[model samples]
Target: MTIAPAASTSALSFDPADPVALTQALVRCPSVTPEEGGALALLATALAAEGYEVHRPVFSEPDTPNVENLYARIGSEGPVLIIAGHTDVVPVGDAAAWTREPFAGTIENGILYGRGACDMKGGLAAMAAAAIRYRRANPDAPGSIAFLVTGDEEGPAVNGTVKLLEWAHRRGERFDHCILGEPTNPATMSDMIKIGRRGSLTGRLTVQGTQGHVGYPHLADNPIRGMVRLLAALDATPLDTGTAHFDPSNLEVTTLDVGNPATNVIPAQAKAVFNIRFNDVWTPETLAAEIERRLREAAGNTVRYEIGFQPTNAVAFLTEPGPFVAMVADAVAAETGKRPALSTTGGTSDARFIKSYCPVVEYGVVGKTMHQIDESVAVADVLALERITHRLLASYFAAQHNA
Candidate 1:
């Protein structure tokens, strides 16, 4: 797919100091998951205008959609600080239910409305605006400032940050510290900062049995009976109580399928799918083994079953509190007058992949409206986030210079 520039009428002038305007410009692009929708193109134009060497690389997997990503850098020296986020928003379900145009970037009573108003086009705009203002103020900053924006964040994530990071690494690009602008706050903008994320493991369990009449007492085996027992056994045990920096591990059964429509027929097969969000207490390998052991105990020697795990990229990770984390917390407090809590209480994010490269953390606007109808963000909060991000950059660079 061709990456087109934002249409002239919809394309507002690029101003990195005005995050609200930048967000509006971004919201105007209906860049739903896997579709460029002119969002990255618009960002590239804006970054290039700010003297950033911008690169838009389109990555493709065999069956997944081709994704467009942006990697723009300003400077070539030490202590590189990378700010990362995604432009793609989830699909707007039931468009007719929206109070206004989902892509109009409409501002009504100091609120901006759109599909990605909060989950995270607003945050992306905030980071961009802050970085531009910082660089403009201090032209010869000590280190490089780069953006790792991607389009596949809300999708399968195959052709986005993961690949972008690898691509950048191959090109010898390195960063000292990184910030992900995912909507981390639960209520207010200063409520929290995510230091880590729980790992996700999805398992599909299938039990096979002979098909026969339901009324027959000894003619057939009911796989549903075994499946229920197996699911119960999986759910009955707790993975972990709770770690100091992480939450208690939890397993939830997402789906159960028998596919038998007739009430009088015993189904030939039964399947159950469960997803476990675990803490740092267990690795993916150990967790999978524990689950299998439980299933075996539950099945006994009678039921024939097989279990398979879905291929996942998410793994539990933590960015131990250190100088970089303290600097970020100080920045948030300085801007918002509230000391943000260092937490690891959210779902997996791109940070899982980034932690292997460098220290990373997440902070952004409140997440209450993400993926909801009439999704919107307060205009003031967007500006505040920009200020917070600017403060973070300022403090980060100063600390780097002093060191």
Candidate 2:
């Protein structure tokens, strides 16, 4: 599938220069999770200048940190397309590791350097710049587009898109589809697209026993022994054989702690933490029960243990082959001539939430440098991404209207 001709100043009316600038603008803002840091205000101003009706909502749950989010709509008709992303970034660790200032948004040797540059301030800029270009060319284009942005995607996620979706739904707002600008590609811009994601579950286990001198092995029931047995039981059993759409479910032990410093003392307690990245074979509830059952059998009634699960709604989900996935696959082929894989390999993402509201997929810049020191995106790749996004918007809407 060939894309429309290279954008001219007429078809590509928006300042091509501003996309990199917008990325730099966002990176300069220290909008860490749960902090607006003026990022939302800057985005709101940019969208409002383009005639979008924008809404900024600050939401809070009883215990979660209060969050700020934004939703903007430019038209209000059929096939409403939603472009969703987050302005918040994870904390930049050890600024000394960076070649340039983390927030400097520096451009050197044709690469943009900053915290959110790849993970996804750059993606957001591409979307915004493309929207501007599309609007300028097709001033009366059919259908409509909106942006559902959140500031809590990087935090505990208590008051972000999950709440924003409900708020928008109450106001009678609906979306036919959504595209998240998460950096999904691995080594190259056209390497892959995330059609689905594996689910994640975290659990903590605490085993209790008598505290005593190590010399008196016969009298003291060492909690460390019980912890070892329980952990081995869980690890010995495979979660499942495997699934066609997903890889084998794997569990990894994250932490094992006893806290006892004395060489002659048997600690009164032992703790182990484990996380599972599972496939569709298990849900949070079922997998959790299975874990408890294993622990019970392993201890053999000798040790008292407490298992606590901090379940996240990162349920495994897939967007079946359809127009949404097809549009991206075709766009990647058109731009790079490579047939990218429709993968479910990565850890969970915000798409886990958006999937429940509408069919969603993730595609964006190659992420070789994302979350690493001096994270950067190549200038040529960024330009290619803008072209790909612009073509997708045009083709997606064109198909929606035609259908």
Candidate 3:
């Protein structure tokens, strides 16, 4: 069910300096995927009150849902630091399974419980809070602190960062670096910082065959036999020996379906869906061509087959460990007493879009509970991340000023 603005909605207040309160207020909006749920409106008001020039742009792509996005900035100058996030969260499946109301932003003991608590509403709040603090302290701070918040990240991803970045570029907005507040840490708040992400490609492969009764052995051609052979060939060879900062590319066949349940018949068609998490070694075009090569070689003109590749914008990217990387790591180390590892082992994020314009890395809350029932984040970690982000913001401008 889509959340309506005029129904079951009311004005919600927030303190720009308090992230926990911001998280609760934002989560309470129920901004489920593709729904505004007043999250952007609430943020716009808060940011505007803090003297930010806010713009709520509505983007649309044919066939996909039109989504509302937020782009707010305080200072516009050289070396802009774009803070990116999403208000849209995955749906709460089987709401009855949750220990508390998923959108209520309940707190138990020391944990904040809610749907988007850790997945990213909390992370986004922390970023906003930290930026507010920095801006209030340094009203004339050098560089820029802009937000690229979207409501389509958990959906088709068509009307979100991919388009928002283009909109920013069209207006001659240049970004020097980006910090995406996703729930990147797997265990503790300081375990890992995602420096890169593997590219993803999904494909559908179909094999054609003849259908006949069980009594006719010679007339029936079983596509299942061809499917098994082709599947093996696809996964038989290693895509690469692992990139310098990434794991070896891997392909997994997610589903295989023939659509025939009867025992006395041979299915006329067999289709399989597969996805690949590839490294920087291959582009989508090269990878698709290689898969076709393998299929044609294995089929050898005997098995009639078809292949189709889905459009992908998620190409592998890396923010090589440089001055910007060191600054962020220092800020985290200052809070955690340990240096976080610069890792490239994770699924995709909006960073893929941001990287096209500037160097982008990810850091946020402990993601153990994101997208799961009874999702929650520790109060300590949330506050700690805010402090870390605050330090990063301060140090970032200090460096720019000194330079």
Work out the TM-score per prediction.
Answer: 0.96, 0.94, 0.96
Q: What's the ranking of the predictions by lDDT, best on top?
A: 1, 3, 2
**Number of the candidate with higher lDDT, 1 or 2:** 1
Enumerate clash totals for all models, in the order shown: 0, 0, 0
lDDT of 3: 0.89
List the global CA lDDT of all models.
0.90, 0.84, 0.89
In candidate 3, stretches whose alpha carbon ends up further than 4 angstroms from where it belongs are 1-14
- Judging by lDDT, tell me the better candidate of 1 and 3: 1
Pairs that collide in candidate 1 are none
Model 2 C-alpha lDDT per residue in residues 1-403, reported as the tens digit of each score:
1111211222222343367877888888888788887677777777777777888888888878888888888887868888889999888999888889998889999999998899888888888778878877877788888988889988888789888888888889988888888888898888999888999999999999899998998878799888988898998979898787789889999999999999999999999999999999899999999998888888886878999999588988888878789998898889998978888898777888888888998888888887888989877777777888888889988987788
**Comparing 1 and 2 by TM-score, which wins?**
1
Residue-level lDDT tens digits of model 3 in 267-296: 999999999999999999999999999999
Residue 319, candidate 1: Cα error in Å is: 0.4
Candidate 1 lDDT over 232-259, as tens digits, reads: 8988978889888998999999999999
User: In terms of lDDT, which candidate is strongest?
Assistant: 1
